[model samples]
Target: MRKIFFSGAVLTASLLLGACSSTDSPAPAPSARASHNAADATFAQQMIPHHQQALEMAKMVPSRSSNPKVVDLASRIDRAQDPEIRQMQGWLSAWGVAATSHSMPGGHEMSGDHSMTGMMSDADMKSLDAAKGPEFDRAWLEMMIKHHQGAVEMAKTELAQGADAGAKALAQRIIDAQQAEIAEMQGLLKQG
Candidate 1:
């Protein structure tokens, strides 16, 4: 009788311990994967402005050049990045965050070169605007390579510290794909 009672207590304790462990598992990891909290909300917000700026640069290519290569490259950039903007917007909606708020993103005003990658400054935009023929193509390639490099850096930062898996996955993809594009742009510049 004593042996059976002792064994029953042990079995009950084991079941209770198992239940406690399973409940705790749901809290930390699942919170990290889907949906938004502060980290994911901030990521999409900051990334929207960043992506919008890149789109502007990509859109400028066709009118600025007659070079088929430059035109093709510009089109590719536009096609790739425009959807990112929309996707990020969707993320913001799903996360219950406002895409545009009265305040600036990541808690600061996002002006100047340091805030974004491959972002064309006022003078850079002017230069591209005025450039024509081979000059236009060369300038576009050089500037875009620098731009893509900037994006690669930003993506790396997101992968390191970002919380949401979806956002992290997208960032990793950008880093891989943009690095390849940067290499291609470098090759084109060298050939020029």
Candidate 2:
């Protein structure tokens, strides 16, 4: 009777511990994932393609732009935005949301046609692509300035509406960085 009672006590303790451990293991992950809302999802979905367009524009600078400053700006935009694109994509994946298409019928990445603020039209991209030397430099700067403005607008929207802490933090960073870049680009434009 003593042996049986001791074994039963040990089994009960083991079962309780196992139950607690199993329940606790999955708790934090779902809560973390649940913290995001529809606004957060929208920001990620829209911004991914927006960032992709900026990358496409940035890629044009090396061969077409004669200004060293413009080339450097393009390089910086590429470096900063690529990781952000990936980060946003990761967020979408973690949230179990699919990202919006990066390409549409018009050769632009944005889905909403001209409604997405500051996105270059297909014509605008073609014009920029056709330009070279100083013309290319000026066009790239102007277009990039507009692109950054659009990103700033989206980030502002995210900050206002997003529930996820990480997304809000990223939005703040985007506003700061892009505003500084906008100032720099404006100065460059004035220089030209």
Candidate 3:
């Protein structure tokens, strides 16, 4: 029961945080929320780079991992994030904000850590790229758990502070999805 509740907490955290990040783009002005609240802007700016690193990390797994679980999770991460990146780009353009930096992760007091809270460091990525077989699978799972948690934290901030309806909704979705992924990653960790 305690585990169930903890999982619920993670879920709630994800709903609050995940729905907040937008690697896609800024909200377009013509879309009613043009004059986005400061929170919304911050969410987009921070999320773009946050998602980018996840993509970078996800791409590394296929070649490095031989395990089906690692491959499946990496594929899901890429599939989910690719469209989000495009969506965020569109939002930024419409909002009249320059999506600007593609080089770093989200960095607001909201998203906090740009590297998604140390989920994927330069060394982590480099190590994953170097690893093969089961070793790659283990490293990938460990890094992804942290990355997903970072997303949850950022989403919680958005749910708490963001005024834009769309941003809030997305933040909720992120909380749901990523928390589930965290569970999956944990299971993999136990197996390893």
For this target, which candidate reaches the highest TM-score against the unseen true structure? Answer: 2
Residue 4 in model 2: shift from native, Å? 25
The local distance difference test score of each candidate is: 0.74, 0.87, 0.76
Q: What TM-score does candidate 2 reach?
A: 0.81
TM per candidate: 0.73, 0.81, 0.74
Q: What CA RMSD would you report for each candidate?
A: 5.0, 4.4, 18.3
Q: Model 1, poorest ten-residue lDDT window?
A: 24-33
On residues 38-84, what C-alpha lDDT tens digit does candidate 1 reach at each position? Answer: 65666677667666766777787777776777677778878888888
Ten-residue stretch with the least lDDT total in model 2: 23-32
Please give the lDDT score at residue 25 for candidate 2.
Answer: 48
What is the full ranking by lDDT, best candidate first?
2, 3, 1
137 in model 3: Cα distance from truth in Å?
1.0
Candidate achieving higher lDDT, 1 or 3: 3
Model 1 TM-score relative to the real fold: 0.73
For model 1, the stretches where C-alpha displacement exceeds 4 angstroms are: 1-34, 37-39, 100-114
Candidate with the larger lDDT of 1 and 2: 2
**Stretches of candidate 3 exceeding 4 Å from the true structure:** 1-35, 101-119
Write model 3 residue lDDT over 88-142, tens digit each, in one string.
Answer: 6676676777675434343322232234454465656777789888887887888
